[model samples]
Target: MTATAPHFEAPPVRAPRRSVQALLEARFAALLVAPAMAVIALVAFYPLGHALWLSLWKINLRFANTPWVFVGLGNYVDAITDDARWLNALRVTLTITFTSLLAEFVLGMIFALVMNQSFKGRALVRASVLIPWSLTTVVSARMWQVIYHASYGVFNRILVDIGLIDAYKPWIISPVFTIWAMIGADVWKTTPFVALLLTAGMQLIPGELYEAAAIDGATAWDRFWRITFPLLRPTMLVALLFRMIDVFRMLDLPFVLTGGGPGQATETLSLYTYRVIFTDLKFGGGSALAVLTFLMILGSAFIFIRVLGAPVAGAESER
Candidate 1:
């Protein structure tokens, strides 16, 4: 009789998919995303559109009285076929980006390893390592300019004292050596930053893995190659990507130190773009060059993502 009399209530139902509450939540989400989309359009797409419009004209400020004439893609054509200096700048930019980043990665990894060790003075060492990175690019370039001076520079003096050279050479004057000097300065200044990133990555790795590897009789080199490098690959790729982008857009050092001098040996795409826009006063050509440079950078990022297998975590989660 009790069982027959007993009754139970069903679970409460969820609101309908197209209900007022669901529609309100959907609208709120769209509203939140709208601001970001608007900001991106304003900051990024607007400039790109303006550049595209500018690129279609022949507007040289030097010709103050002349009107803006449409040249269509003539600026782009000249950049590829006619402008030798622009081509040279592209070559130099690629050279610096590749070589400097290579040295930075290797040296940075070494510094990271040293800093990751258990030591009494580790904090001090880490601080000292970051000093060069903390200094502004302009300050570092100007300082290196003095250091690379032919006669009175510390570098030349040390080389002479050590018998590496018979005389103080004009390091910045030679086209061949000028890039090397720039690379040296860049590597010295930014390697510490790479090291800092790598050190942080290394710290995240569990010590248990290393201890287990040691128990299995793995040598230091084996542990590094098998465990450390494999684990730190994502961090290394991220550091490499950042430095690549930075070096691609490098201007402050070249502007201050080389001025794209010694026969245009150190002219980067960014430096070249600046000179074209301000020095040559050809806004159309400069805008075209800017667009081309942007495409190259995008291509490089694509290559890195493919070669390193470092799919962005946020992108993966979104998918």
Candidate 2:
């Protein structure tokens, strides 16, 4: 070998101190969140994943002895293209969701404005308004069922007294009326929730802004349109999203009120899935329906996020 200079390795380049601390902090933050992430994955995602897995098989609990038959996406395809019940339920679900959402938005906005004003008995009004929302859904649904009762219902009694109808017609039994009744009940029960949300948003706004608007000669209508509504958009979107999700998966009211009856006129997607799984004992089909419903809800959340430019009520500033 010819004579050669001693080979030497270059000294290791050290990272900047601040960058090293940042990286370590990021790792520590991730470590802190890992337990909560694990809990969420275990609690929330496990059932969803299990449902997805079950949806791919033909698992008829009635015949548990038979091995699960893998049908890939057949169940989903059947629900989409073949099942008439599923189609009808989807239509009913959309109708209720849209109509109730519209009505609730309007009424809720009005109630929120009124509650935001400085007036006597304001605290009492807020409490009274929240009572409907605070009651359990099952209790509210049962209360509505009694109110729409065919024989002794207050609705029919009032209508008869006013002579709107010649006799006490069964509003809950008639196909057309049954759907409308459910929509009305849902709007009544949930509008307060929307109002509550909007009221909270309204409170966050500085009252001095309103005073300044008044000094600038902005009419009440103009102020509402310009100042109130602009700031309330995030909250409005949140309430809309929450109500949409709840109505999309509605079960108690329909179950207690119509039981998806009147010749399946009011069968919602939730009720349909329940019957498919429990009543029909077709867990696979039900799982597919459930998964489809979850996807729809997830898609709706994205639509809200994109359309409103908000991740939630408070994330608009982040955007």
Q: Among these predicted structures, which one has the highest TM-score?
A: 1
lDDT (10s digit) by residue, model 1, range 6-102: 3432444466834876789899999999999999999999999999899988888987787888999999999999999999999999999989999
Q: Among all windows of ten consecutive residues in candidate 1, which has the lowest summed lDDT?
A: 4-13
For candidate 1, give the lDDT of residue 201: 96
Q: List runs of model 2 lying over 4 Å from the truth.
A: 1-32, 313-319
State the lDDT of candidate 2 residue by residue for 1-319, as single tens digits. 2334233324444569658978999999999999999999999899899999999988888765877889999999999999999999999999999999999999999999899889999989988998998888888888988898999999999998988998887888998799999899989989999999999999998889999999999999999998999998878877888889899999998888788989899999999999999988899989999999999998988888886565575445633
The 10-residue segment with the lowest total lDDT in model 2: 1-10
lDDT measured at residue 239 in model 1 versus the true structure, 0 to 100: 84
Off by over 4 Å in 1: 1-37
TM-score of 2: 0.87
lDDT of each: 0.90, 0.90
Give Cα distance to truth, residue 170, candidate 2, Å.
0.9
Deviation from native of the Cα of residue 244 in model 2, angstroms: 1.1
